[model samples]
Target: MDNKTFSLQTDLALYCRTGLYEPQTSIQEHTFHYRRLVYNVIKDTLRRAFPMTRKLIGKRRWKKMVMHFFEYHKCQTPQVWKLPQEFSDYYQQVNFPFKKKFSFLVTLLQYEWLEIEVFMMEDLPIDEFSIEKKSQEDRIIPNPEIKILSTEYPVHLKNGKEITEEDKGQYFVSVHRDFYTKQIQFNDLSYPFVEIILKANEGCFSRKDFIELLAKYDSDREKIMKLYQDFEQFALQNTIFLGYQI
Candidate 1:
């Protein structure tokens, strides 16, 4: 009703959500009900966002971590889907079940979350057929939703199974949401291409350097140039579909 009343009510609701305190009054009981409701909603949102992480950890541990996140983590974004985007950050800051046991936990969370993040992005949506081939020195536009991720584990090959030594190979993964199908796509990008895309996204890494960088990967000039052609072709065909903003 008043400022003090609202503040107390808010605090009480938060406490209930955190499982720190129970409702004391009729209104507080309603607050508790809504608090639990909101907690479950946020939990479900995170569960969808990090399905692989949840699978890796199991329901009990995942629920416990979710509760911990619910109690201690402060969400910066108002959007529900973006809530789990901070889970990895919180996990890193807070030493919990995944403190050191799960080496790929944070990276796996990121790889999984990228699907949701990219799918929700608002991009310019350039068509592949309309995109023109540009020289290596020219700055080429890249898909806005594309995220370049590098990790020791083959996070791209994650199939909900627990991690082992065999999954320890380093990988460069590009996850983007396709404009035509609006489906999330995974591309295992090569060395120079990965570097080029990462820099290109930042408004750097022209086509000339794109080929030059690839050339460094191989001593054979003709083979390296061919790789450049294929790389540029893929970008023009698929990546352009996500369209370029800058």
Candidate 2:
């Protein structure tokens, strides 16, 4: 397309998003109708993406927030489903009016967006390895489609309105898509366990490595060994650890 046509299209998009531009008298009526349609599409898509956030903030406030995002933020992703992630990013960087009232808003947005992310993420290749043959020396294999989130608010446990000052503390959560079921799952994790999963992601850790890591928190060798065993059992049950890598 020519530069003038491209520029016109770009201006139209900005006008639609911000409701600040007036087109030529000849096309004003059609432009108004098209802008309304565009706004509705964006509003509806964001509403579905952040249902929990909307519930916590009320409809009127949610509408205003959506408008703020539409007007001020230039979204990077073309995919409709990925827009929520962009919105979350925008929420963190921009100073929204409701931010003071809802300090945990960004964390809540992240928590909600991650569920969609895990649900829509593409599948990863699974290597042929037997759980029965797993050994301490074997490097662990973590589920590829997983995310670890750390938040000061228990956004994972409590809704935004329900969260209070008392509930503000360090919290770790593992969000993963089950390998066989393709279902998204959330697991609350302690600090040490969170560390183990993070380290495992860097490069799969062996059982011995897991023990030594846990030993840092507790000096009891026997207790550390037992904890590692328990972790292995839990990881296998939840598909957190897919299997031992060959």
Candidate 3:
């Protein structure tokens, strides 16, 4: 496209996104209608993506926040569904009045966005591994689509408005899609379990490896064994460990 055509399109997009810089033409009235339609589409998409956030922030402030994001934040994603991820990123970085009051907002955005991410994630290639091999000596393979989120607030358990000073503590959550069912699942975990999953994500780990790793932290054999057993059950039940590598 020519410079003038490109410039015109850019201006229209800005107007649609921010309701600013209306093109000086006879079609200005039509452009206003088009802009409203564009804004509503984005608003609806965001509303669905973050229903809990909207409820906590209230309608008036949420609308203002959306307008602020629309006007100032230059969204990069062409996909409507993925736009919330960008918004989440933007919210975390930008300083907002609500952020001070709602300290857990960023974590909440991440928690909610993860559900969409896990559900829409592409199928991981597990052809090399065999689920039939379940042995302590064999290295366990984790689902490639899994994600672990560590936050200061228990956004997974409570809404933004519901959280208090008592709720401010370390929270670890594992969000993953079920390998067979294709359903998204969330699991609350302790710090040690999070560490184990992080290690597993780095590479395959066998039950023996986890036991040795735990031994480095604690010399008590019984404690290490119990912790390993708990993690083993959690991993297998959630499909965090898809299977043992062949």
List the global CA lDDT of all models: 0.73, 0.86, 0.84
Span of 10 residues, lowest total lDDT, candidate 3: 127-136
* Per-candidate alpha-carbon RMSD to the true structure: 3.7, 2.1, 2.1
Q: Quick one: best lDDT, which candidate?
A: 2
Off by over 4 Å in 2: 24-29
Listed in order, each prediction's TM-score against the native is: 0.81, 0.91, 0.90
Candidate 1 — what's its lDDT?
A: 0.73
Q: Tell me the deviation in Å of residue 150 in model 2.
A: 1.0
**Candidate 3 backbone collisions, by pair:** none
State how far residue 216 of model 2 sits from its true place (Å). Answer: 0.4
Which sections of candidate 3 miss by over 4 Å?
24-29
* Model 1 ranges with Cα > 4 A deviation: 1-6, 21-29, 124-129, 132-140, 160-162, 202-209, 240-246
Candidate 2, residues 33-109, lDDT tens digits: the string is 76789778889888988988999999888988888888878878788889999888988988777788988888989
Clashing pairs in 1: 126-243, 136-207, 136-208, 137-208
Model 3 whole-model lDDT (C-alpha atoms): 0.84
Residue 179 in candidate 2, Cα distance off native in Å: 0.8
